[model samples]
Target chain A: MDNVASLMHGFSVALTTHHILLMMAGVLLGILVGVLPGLGAPNGVSLLLPLTFSMDPVSAIILLTSLYWGALFGGSTTSILFNIPGEPSSVATTFDGHPMAKQGRATEALSFAFLSAGFGAMAGVILITLLSGWVAKFALKFSSPEYFAVYFMTFASFIGLGGASPLKAIVSMGVGFALASIGMDSVSGNVRLTFEFDALLGGVSFLIAVIGLFGIGELIITMEEGLKFEGVQAKVRISDVLRTAAKLPRYWVALLRSSLIGIWMGITPGGPTAASFMSYAMAKRTSRNPAKFGKGEPEGVIAPETADHAAGSSAMLPMLALGIPGSATAAVMMGGLMIWGLNPGPTLFTDRPDFVWGLIASMYLGNVVAVIVVLATVPLFASILRIPFAIIGPIIVAICFIGAFTVASKSFDIWLALAFGVVGYLFKKLDYPIAPLVLAMVIGDKAEDAFRQSMIFSQGSLSIFWSNALVSTLMAIGVVLLLLPLVGMIAQRLRGRTAQSTV
Target chain B: MITRFWAESATAVATMAFGLIIVYGALEFGIGWDSSGPQPGAFPFYTGLLVALASLGTLALTIGRRIAGNAGLQESFLDAERFKRVASFFLPLLAFVVLSVTLGMYVATILYLVFAMRFQGGYGWLPSLATAFGAAAFFYLALEKFFQIGLLKGPLEPLLGL
Candidate 1:
């Protein structure tokens, strides 16, 4: 009842004329960003971040979150029409989405993707509304040791659960932490890793890193592939959209199951991309006629789309409640939260309920707006994709550089971005996971602070982590997660040895 | 052509070197724990060490795979044609960064777009110049005028003073 009242108040705070207009503009710009290759939700959000510097925190968040929803929707548009996924999360959509388009059911495919995505996002928001208070209250009891334990658990989970080689994951995460510690050490007040360069005083901005990695790095790969867009022409009829919407309820089982999977993944850091793939796999495995999955099955389209948006939205809970982002995009948004003079943790809920709840309330409005706007503008975005890559490509490059420069008006950052861009391209090509790096950079300093603070509390004794039951449980979980992969590998080897002996 | 084996090995070596560099840099500050707490360098030192070790592991794994006659390692990471395409795109991008520093971002934006459109895209001078100027103007209005954020300006902006 208290939570419901708070949400009603949140609705009041978010339901402003200015906010509604900003949401529309954000969605429109986000669709443009999502429709174009090389510009993803993280890139778009970071690029637009500078523009929002002057705005209030509430409006800034509204605009950015709306853009996020819009980008997710726009990603599916390209998947269905061009057979190219605009976002990593949308890749699974192409398996059946493009086939549906080829079969002249483009309208049905588009409508199903958007409507199911909307449903998933709503489910995620409702979960947030219901669970946010309990999470925040639970987190309020946390101390430095608990904080360190949480950060430990997050990184450990990534290494254990992520598909990348554990060694590569560790390397990626270590690089991010090292890079983050380069500038000033707030606790000790010592400049650590400047290497005597003046620019190293403030350290490397994660924003610059993101621009280089996702924006320029992705563009280079796209160029290497020599991509061409031979898109299926989409002609969405209002009647068809209505007809598709009517048929969505028939897949209630898939929708409900996917939403659960998405919410679980979102909260646990598997993220939207992982969630979508897992959901698609589950949908296929459970289907009576699995062969139809890649042959224009509606369930194929519905499952991934639902899970993607569900994970995208639900991921915000951990970011807001515990300051641990569930995905790369959430990591960027959490960075924005720090910049906006707001800390993203349990205190943020009590300190700025209006901001937290308003953002939550806006998610409801934004997804509804995203679906309507995307449904009506599919053809327009498809036509935009028809533009020559040579033109669109250069423009994206320009946007990236411009966005980087605007970060601090430093020419040095332009150079740094280019360097990271090369690193990004090479990392992508080499199968090195970049998310751990981004996540590490975002929370590196905080985690370090938590560890040092806990050490101080225990007079430099590492046992402080296991001092309390809460912290002990958290640390135990982290240790298990960290060792799980190694254990599995050893088990596999033992099994292989047994099989060889039998042979 | 570059094989996957070489590419993997080179990347592993590079990351290893990067980790060692961080480790060295971290030594400047004492990597110790005092009565106050862990030293500033302690965090980075361990992270750097972790990176170095993991990178070594990757390097060893790559070599072990090659030694075991992994056929996939023989495949090309970047063939000649793909290299050509990547270079063509990367060189112009490198030029744009250079121009952004010396010539300023707005002017660089215009010139880069025009060159890409007219030369690379094979579009007409009319459309190229039109797009070049149009995009520059739009960015000027959006970033500078609307957002009130000043972008990098070179000597040209001073001479074209209002």
Candidate 2:
């Protein structure tokens, strides 16, 4: 009941005229950012972060979160119209969305995609509002050891559960840790890795790293691919949208199932991309007419879109309640929170109830606004796909350079962005998992502080991690997750041997 | 010139080398435990060690595959046509960075835009130049006037004297 009351209070805060305008502008820009290749949610947020430095924390968060919702919708538009996934999570949407567009059902597919996304986001927000208090209360008991264990679990899961090779993931994470260890150590106040260079003293900013890695790095790869933006043409209609929306009740099972999958993945570290893929696979396996899945099926569009938005929205829950982000974009948003002088985790709920609830309230309004804006302006956003890549590419690079410099108003960061761009380009080429590296970069300092705090508490005794059941259980999970790949490899080898012997 | 396998192998070796350097650096900061508990170097020392070990593991995997004749060494990093395309825009980007440093963001942006659009985009000189000027003017108004953020400026600012 208190939670519901708090959410209602949040609605009062969110429904202010200024806040609504900010949300509207944010969603519009977010769609533009998403439609543009090489500029994603993280990059968009990073680029705009410097501008929000002077704004109130509540408004800043509303704008960014609304933009996030808009980007999700925008990515879907490109997927349906161009077969080009504007966001990584929308990859599965293209598998069937483009096919639907091909069959002259683009309006139906577009309507289904946005409506499902709206539904999924609503479900995710409801779950977060219901579960956050309990989760916060549980997390309030965590000590430094347990905190360190959680961070370790995140890194370990990236290694164990990543699509890339485990060794490659470790290498990426290791590099991130090394980069994070530079600049001034917050606890000891001692400089490490600067080698007396003036620019290295403040350390490498995660914002700069993110801008370089995702923004500039993606530009290089797109340039390499010789990007072409010409896409399929379609006209959306109100009647068609209504007709398709009227049919949405039949897939209640899929909508609910995908929302559940998305919520689970969002809370965990699997993220939206994984959730969408998992939901689509589950939908395909369970559907009666699996053969029709890739041939422009409405369920195909709904399952992934629903799960993607659900996961994207719900990923914020962990960040708000636990100070841990479930995805890279969430990590950047958490960084923004830290910049606004707000601490995430249990303290966030206790200290800043207004901001928390306000953000939650805006999520509800933002998605509704996103659906309306995207539907009304599909042709305008879709036409962006027709712009020549050559013109778009250089401009993106310019934005990245300017964005990096604005982070600290330093010329040194422009060079840093260039260096990391090369690193990002190479990492992509080598099939290295970049997400773990980015996540590690953002969280490394906090994790290191937690480790050192635990050490100080235990007088250098590592066994302190196992002294309590909570910390010990978390540590055990971390270790198991880290070793899961090895165990799987060995089991596979054994199975292969047995099969050969039987043969 | 390097094959994909060798390139990855080199990356692993470089990682290992970096780890060794970190370990040496951490030693100077003192990794020893004391009454105050672990020292500053303790965590970094171990982190470096972990990095070194994992990188070695990657290197080992690459080598093992090579010995088994399954390393796929014949695959080059980038084919000829792809390399040509990447260099087209990449070289201009490098120029744009240097030019921005010397010529301010606005002028540098205009020049780069015209060049990229004309050469890479195959646009006519008039359209390319007009679009470049339009974008530069918009950015100046939006970023500088509205947002009140000062980007890099060069000698051209005083000449306009706005």
Candidate of highest TM-score: 1
Q: What's the true lDDT of residue A236 in model 2? A: 80
In angstroms and one decimal each, the interface RMSD of every candidate reads 0.8, 1.6
Per-residue error for A348 in candidate 1, Å, reads 0.5
DockQ of each: 0.90, 0.67
Candidate 2 on A1-503: residue-level lDDT in tens?
Answer: 98999999999999999998999999998999888888888889888999999899999999999889888898999999998888889999998999999998899999999999999999999998998988998999998999999998888888887768898888888878877888777777778877668998888888888888888888888877876765778778888889988999999999999999999888888889989999999999999999999999999999999999999999999899988898888988988998899999998888999999999999889889888988998999888778777777888888888898889887788889888887788887787877777778788889889998999998878899999999989989989988998999999999999999999
- Model 1 Cα lDDT, one tens digit per residue, A240-335: 999999999999999999999999999998899999999999999999999899999999999999999999999999999999999999999999
Query: Residue A243 CA error for candidate 2 (Å)?
Result: 0.7
In the range B15-73, model 2's lDDT, one tens digit per residue, is 88877777777777778876666677777787788889988998998888888888475
Residue A257 error, candidate 1, Å: 0.5
| Backbone collisions counted per model | 0, 0
Using Cα atoms with residue i matched to residue i, what is each candidate's TM-score against the true structure?
0.99, 0.97
Model no. 1, DockQ: 0.90
The alpha-carbon deviation from the true structure for residue A383 of candidate 2, after best TM-score superposition, in angstroms, is: 0.5
Cα-based lDDT at residue A369, candidate 2: 89
